[model samples]
Target: MRELTESETRVLFEKLSKYIGRNITDLIDRPDEPFCFRLQKDRVYYVSEKLAKLASNVSRDNLLSLGVCMGKFTKSGKFNLHITALDILAQYALWLKPSGEMSYLYGNHVLKAHIQKMSEDCPQHQGVIICSANDQPMGFAVSARAAVECKTLEPTAIVGYHQADLGEYLRGEETLA
Candidate 1:
């Protein structure tokens, strides 16, 4: 994947700000701050943190995954590209292995915790966590039901399957494009 030029980055940020109805001037004054000030305060920091991680990866999958994670976690309710938060968290766990702070189980647990937190804090976003936890078959069934309801109210991209496949597909790939 081609690295985004400085101008492209600026344009992309502007577009995102506009799409979310955030004032560009406010964001310029505090670039480190989140775009979702009151609508979904928790999501602002969550998204900013995810973007910081994506900035280090050269793969398109990684970038897309980051975008999906942001959209899912924030429950933006628009399908762009389906990327699962579990996948990103799992990758972070692997990267943090050297620090001995996280194992696969630990990572999975953290993912579950985050999902649960999101569900509790944002009832409207509860389906996002449910859908991403669908690897558990039973969870998937429940999520599917929730998703059906969510879909009637608003469109949400399904991401669990896509995220599950990304790790395998990118394993030996030479380029990101």
Candidate 2:
């Protein structure tokens, strides 16, 4: 495990900021305990300072993982946010209709007809947290159309592209363990 380099930090934050926006600061400057990001096997872990310090005592070979597995960096250096980071992104998310929830969970793109509502300022291609009507975080997606555009679009028009979803937890159970 090691610290993220300057370039890696930039890449990671750029991907995260797309979904959570300025809330990234709240992750760093927390009221309870300070948390930090650490890299282990290309996967970024969001760990508390105390736990990270304790984890430092263990050798790299034996430490399988640290805290929450935020995501991983590809060989090409692109960061992919994992479903595990949903808790943090849930704060500012796009709410979907109940009809859309199942489709999204099945890894299908969100259709305009399924959208209950979205943020007023949501723009096309922006990363957004996808939630159910009950406000449950379902996954993450990239908006396919701007808020205004959706109003004039057909019901079957794509509104969001699935990036990651909770269904992955069950589908990739073997790999997750």
Top candidate (lDDT): 2
lDDT of 2 by residue, 16-122 (tens): 98987878999988999999999999999999999999999999999999889999999999999988888877988988899889989998999998999888888
Clashing residue pairs for model 1: none
> 112, model 2: CA deviation in Å?
1.6
For each candidate in turn, the TM-score is 0.21, 0.91
Query: Backbone clashes per model, in order?
Result: 0, 0
Tell me the whole-model lDDT of each prediction, alpha carbons only. Answer: 0.29, 0.91
Compose the digit string of candidate 1's lDDT tens values, residues 99-156.
2222222222212222311221222212222222323211110122232333343223
Best by TM-score: 2
True-vs-predicted CA distance for residue 73, candidate 2, Å: 0.9
Residue pairs with colliding backbones in model 2 are: none
